[model samples]
Target: MTENKNNRTITWIVGGILILLLAGVSVLLISEKKVNKELTQEFELEKEDLENQYTTFARQYDELKLTVSNDSLSSLLEQEQLKTQRLLEELRTVKSSNAREIRRLRNELATLRKVMISYINQIDSLNRLTAQQKEIIADVTQKYNAASATINNLSQEKKALNQKVTLAAQLDATAIEVTPLNKRNKRTKRTKNIVQLKIDFVISKNITAQTGEKTLYVRITKPDNDVLTKNDADVFAYENRNLRYSIKKYIEYTGEEQPVTVYWDVEEFLYAGTYRIDIFTDGNLIGSQNFSLN
Candidate 1:
């Protein structure tokens, strides 16, 4: 009986140890599962924040691009777009808590950003087009004014010139740019066929002269003091001594924001030198601008 009792005690001790070991393993597994769940939850929240921020950023960028008047700011925009794309890619690779559903959400978010980028580019292009159109209109107006002054007999009346000078010059003209259509937007160069410039002025509504034709001339001055002249007598109406224009344009004065533009061919071989342009018409110098070619 004593031997049997000792054998029974040993068996009980072994069974207790086995039970304790199993309990510890169960606790460890439960703790591990809880930690994994929390980590996945945190990651999901972070991903959501990133996605929301990226969307907001893209929207803001588009709004800002619409207002972009300076070409220098374009570089900053492209950089922001690249960063968003990289973040979207990273979001895609992130391991979500639920391997299926969360991953799908991240992928969807990335795709949305990609689509947004495309839309942003399209908006940028549209804005560029609109800007170009305004420039063309201004150019036409300036040229028309110049041609009419030379051709119209009514402009010879001194009182008429004074009346126009007083009112038309007071109305403010918003400056519009005439950048080349094919420009890459990364740099500024005179080598392109069309070199765009901006014209800003004010037109006064009250004038002494009866509404008729007003002549405006835009003469580009090269570094050699030689004025850029044109062969078209209509666009190349005389300003100072020569037929002055690098790009000749004509416009009729309805008197509003007269943003004008003219084109220069690459065949001109613009050397490294300082170039300037002056606009003349309506018995008032409307505007002037200058830039360098290097």
Candidate 2:
């Protein structure tokens, strides 16, 4: 009877061990399933974040196109933009459980970022160079304008100096006298008795004037303001037009005061009124005088 009891006790112990092992296996399986679910959730979140990054990179390429003016650079940016969009589409279609594909796409995102940074640096360099060129052009233009203004000022100064020199070199006449003579060559105040008129003048000394031969014109006017000339064509230049003169004399000037005399024979009828005499040289009126006759 004792032997039988020992065998039964052994069987009961074996059965308890088997039941404990099955319960431990069931707990292990449940824990493993929970861990797997958490891992899958983490992978999905990572994939969503990666997709967002790719979308943002694509949008950035569009913005970069707006900043570039070069046609070749714009074309390159367009290619990059399209590439980023294609990668984004591929990322969206990929299963979250595909870790290999997700990792590869992530590496591609890094490479795209590096390429975009390089392009940005290139664009910045080009912009800085263009700004420098504009500054140089503006500086050159300002200097040219300053030089032109200086030249104009110099030209005006030279013209003014020339005008001053011309004025300083002009000849002047002074000490003028006129005497009416009768048929006996004697001074007379009677207009009807006058047969000739004598004119005398002195040229003033001027060292600046040219020392050479010069022509002098003398005009005599009657009481009626009529110029006395031998012929209508007896003319000399005064200002810009020709004027009738009673007498023309040639003299050699030595830049010294010199006395001159001229005469006119009265051929027309005379009246009792004031008469005038004028002398000119080098197109300038040099002297004038008026006298009364009876």
Candidate 3:
């Protein structure tokens, strides 16, 4: 009977030890499960943060493309943007438990960020250079305009001075006289008794006048305002037009006061009225006179 009691005690101890061991195993399993849950939460948070960074990086690349002007640089930015998008898609597809892939994408994101910063700095430098070039062009244009204006003003002044010099160099005629003469060279007053007309003038002394040969033209108009010319083709230029003259004479000018005389034979019928005489030289009317005969 005692032996039977000892065997029951041993059986109880073995049963208690098994019960405690099972309880310890249950506790260990619960703790391990809690730890696994916490680790999973951490991985999910990390993946979400990485996704946010990748998405933001892609958006920033698009923004950078807009600020770039160089065609090659813009194309490069577009390529980088596509790469960022591809990486973002990969990240989205990756399981939260994939720590290795998540870490790799995070490294790529860092590299992309550094590249974006470099592009931004380059774009800024290019913009500054463009601004400086514009300023220089504006300055040069302004100076060119000023120079053109000055040249125009100087040309106008030169033209005006040349015109004044031309005017000062022209000859002046004075003391003009016209007389009706008979066939005997005596002055007459009656229109029927006159057979010739005498014209006389004096060129005033001018140091500026050209000293050379000159041609003189005399035009006589009757009371009818008809010019008397021996030939219709006896013409001279005046004010860009041809004018018929009654008499032409040639003389040598010496830049000193000189007297000149020209005669016209009265071949046409004379009338009883006023007559006018004009003398021209060098395309300019130098003297004029009026007379009357009965």
Candidate 4:
């Protein structure tokens, strides 16, 4: 009996130790499951944060590209944006619990930020250079405009001076006289007795006038206001157009007062009224006179 009781006690002690071991193992398993759940939640939060960071970086790169005007710089920005986009896609696809991939993405984010800072610096430098160029161009344009205005003013002044000189060099006529003559070359007052009309004038002395052989034109108008010309082709240049002239004569000018006479033969019937005569030289109407035949 003593032997059986000792055996029973030893068996009971072993069973109790087994039960305790099982309880301890159960508690350990529960604790391990809780820890794993907490770790998974933390990994999810980290992955979400990393993804948000990549998304924000991509937005920043997009904005930077829009602000860039240089082709090379814009291209670099585009490439960086694409890189960020690709990383964002990778982060989306990666498992939430993947610590290695998340760590890699974090490192890439830091690198991209540094690159963005460099791009910003370059862009600012280019903007400053462009502003300086604009200022230089504006200054040059202003100077050109001022020079053009000065040249224009000088040209106008020269034209005015030349006009004054031209006017001063023009010749003048004085003492104009007209007479009616008969066939015997005697001065006549009767319309039927007149056979010709004569005009006489004196060219006043002008030191500024040129000494040369000059052509003079004469126009005679009857009392009926009809001009007498040899034909429709009897024309001379006045201003910019051809004007009818009754006769033309050439004379030598010596810059001294000189007498001139021009005659016109009358083939048409003469009337007992006043007749007008105009004399022109060098595109100017130098003298005018009137005569009457009763």
Candidate 5:
């Protein structure tokens, strides 16, 4: 009976040891699951931070394009942007806790940052050179303008001296007289007795004027400001348009004081008012006079 009791005690001790072993294994499994959850959470956080950094780097690349102007540099920047986008797509597809892919992307980001810094330095150098060239061009242009102005001033002075010499060489007329002749070829003051008009003038001598056959035109303006012309087609250039003349005469000008006479026949009705006469030669109004009749 004592031996039977000892055997029962040994059996109970073996059962208790088995139960304790199972409990220990259960506790170990639960603790292992908790540790695995913590490691996954840490990896997930690290992945999220890496993604955020990639996004920030992309934004910086976009901003950098705005600061540059060179076409070649801009193209390079576009290529870099494409590379960054491709890497970001790859990062998105990779699992958050994939340590290998994450580390590769991080290294790429570092390399891209170095490349961006190099491009920035190159762009700055190009901009500074362009500024220096602009300054040099401005200085050269200022000197050219100053020289051009001096040449223009000298040309104007030369033109002015030539004009003074031309003016001193112009001809003149003096001792002008007009006579309204009657039907019997005698001067008359009555409008009804006038049949024609005679104009007499003396050309003053000018040694500077050329000796040649000269044509002179006489413009007769009536009281109503009407010019009496033999024909409507009889016109000469005055300012910029044709002007009607009453009569024209030719003379052999010998640079001496010589008398000249020209006649105009009356074909239109006359009025008892003041009349004006102007004589032109070589595009110059050398003489002007006025007369009145009853």
Candidate 6:
């Protein structure tokens, strides 16, 4: 009986040990599963945080790109940089257990790298374009300066040419000769009643004249230093203004010098003395001469 009792006690002890081993294994399995679950939850949280951060960074980069200068290509480059950040985040988030997802992330990362390279190339191209634009602007400015200088030179030359033409067309004052029919010398004395005074003048052959109606004006000085001219109401056209003349005559003077004859009857008293006569035509005092009457 004691042997049977000892065998039963040994069986019971072995069974209890097995039960304890099973319980320990169950507890261990549960603990391990709980730890694994916690690790999975932590990893998911980390991945989600990375995704959120990457998304936020991408948005910030986009907004920053929008604020870039209008003339720069930095916007595209920044976009690629943001894309690279997002792809890196995705690459880190995808687990090894999800092979397809990891592969997708790898592909995305490769695409992002290509896009970044493209942006780099674009930057190089933009730099080249900027240099080219600078050169073009410089060329245009130089051309404009040259053109302005040429125009200024042309204007100066034109002004000089105009001055020369005007000088060539000018009329001289000493080219007129006059004569009184009965005037012999400066000391000749004349009666108070003079019948008429016949005046004659000659124009210089070098006088530049146009073929137009030229009105000649005459001003005669009497013996008493009196200017013998008609009143302002008897104004006549001569030298581009209203003039007073004792007599009016029209002449068609060609370019060649010609003689002009004018006759004036003295209605007023003519004291005998030296008399000066002025002839004008075409905005110039063409000639002047003196004579005496007896």
Candidates sorted on TM-score, descending: 4, 3, 5, 2, 6, 1
Candidate that would win on TM-score: 4
TM-score of 3: 0.76
Across residues 1-294, which tens digit of lDDT does each residue of candidate 4 receive?
999999999999999999999999999999999999999999999989988888998888888887778999999999999999999999899998888988998898899989989999998898898889899999999999999999999999999988888888787778888888999999988878878888888989988989999999999988999889889899999989998999899999999999999898988887788888888898988888787778
Tens digits of per-residue lDDT for model 1, 1-294: 999999999999999999999999999999999998898788778777766776676567667666665576656666666766666666556665555645665565667667656756766786799889999999999999988987775657666887657754442322423333224433355445334434333333434333445555666677998766546453533444445455544465563334454555433545667777676654445566676665
Which scores better on TM-score, 3 or 5?
3
In Å, residue 233's CA in model 4 sits off its true spot by 3.9
Q: Across residues 9-87, which tens digit of lDDT does each residue of candidate 6 receive?
A: 9999999999999999999999999998887777666556545644654565565455445444665656566666758
How accurate locally, in lDDT, is each candidate? 0.61, 0.91, 0.90, 0.89, 0.87, 0.66
lDDT of 6 at 292: 66
lDDT string for model 2 (103-158, tens) is: 99999999999999999998999889888988998899899989988988888998
Provide TM-scores for the models.
Answer: 0.37, 0.64, 0.76, 0.78, 0.66, 0.51
Off by over 4 Å in 4: 1-39, 183-188, 223-226, 272-276, 284-294
The root-mean-square deviation over C-alpha atoms between each candidate and the true structure, in angstroms, is 31.8, 5.4, 3.8, 3.6, 5.7, 7.5
Candidate 1: worst-modelled 10 consecutive residues by lDDT? 173-182
The better-scoring model by lDDT among 1 and 4 is 4
lDDT of 5 by residue, 1-294 (tens): 999999999999999999999999999999999998898898788778877877887787788889788888889988988888888888888886688888898899889889888988887898898889899999989999998898898889888877876665666767778899999999998888889889898888988787899988989999999999989998888888889999989999998888999898987889998999898888878888898878
lDDT of 3 at 263: 92
Angstrom error of the Cα, residue 41, model 2: value is: 7.3
Off by over 4 Å in 6: 2-9, 12-38, 41-53, 56-113, 116-120, 123-127, 175-294
